[model samples]
Target: MAYLFSGDGGDSDSAVVPLVCLQPFPLLLFASVPVCFILSAALVMMMKVPAFCYWFGCLFCAGMSAEMKAMAMTILYVCCISFLSFSLCIISLLWVFCSVFSAFFLCFFWVLLIVRDCLVFVWGAKIQSETCSLDSP
Candidate 1:
């Protein structure tokens, strides 16, 4: 339809497209780095105490009932598994953050190199033209 193409060149209202900025993605990731580290450290520390307790209980609890021992062992195993999983999750987050940060810098440096080359080419041409003109005169 002609209306689709001609309705609002400048004045009439239309749906406005929102600007999406990606500049803050890396900054948000950087802010999360410390949080990931702290969480992983806390989980690791918590895991150590429970794991030591679980082993110690197994070693010394010869008279404990089978059902109670089984329940206790299950609880300890669950705790250890959960702590390890959480620590692994934090480690993976850190890995992702580092990868994204590296990629962002790699792209930024590539763009910088391209712009620098363009500027150098432009200036070199300008200088060469100026010298040629002076030599002719």
Candidate 2:
């Protein structure tokens, strides 16, 4: 009971690590820390540049009043956000799905697919709105 419940006994001279400390759970947790950080960094990178383009195109494009620019920006954001939400949900479903039976690498493929589709979407919408605004009477 002493070894399981307490960290040290009267013979505290032992150099060995504790049984609990040597478990795989701790190792897995520490291992997952870097993966979490990497995943977060990737999400940030995914959002950042699109944000830059969103702002730049909305603010810098000529012949648009503040209201129109705001509306276009809102539309762009809605589309991007909806697509992201949908993709993540799909990924979550996929995670439950194939993680039960197969390798984890398929998630990456879906992520790439979403990223490509999102980029295409956001940029296409941005361009289309800008063109329509320019073509307006």
Top candidate on lDDT is 1
Per-residue alpha-carbon lDDT of model 2 for 58-90, expressed as tens digits? Answer: 446466676865675566566666756665565
Clashing pairs in 1: none
Q: Score every model by TM-score.
A: 0.52, 0.34
**Over all chains combined, what TM-score does candidate 1 have?**
0.52
Residue 112 error for model 1, in Å? 0.9
Which 10-residue window of candidate 1 scores lowest in summed lDDT?
1-10
Assess candidate 2 and give its TM-score to the true structure.
Answer: 0.34
The candidate scoring highest on TM-score is 1
RMSD of each: 13.1, 32.0
Task: Give the C-alpha lDDT of model 2.
Answer: 0.54
lDDT of each: 0.59, 0.54
The regions of model 2 sitting more than 4 angstroms off are: 1-60, 103-137
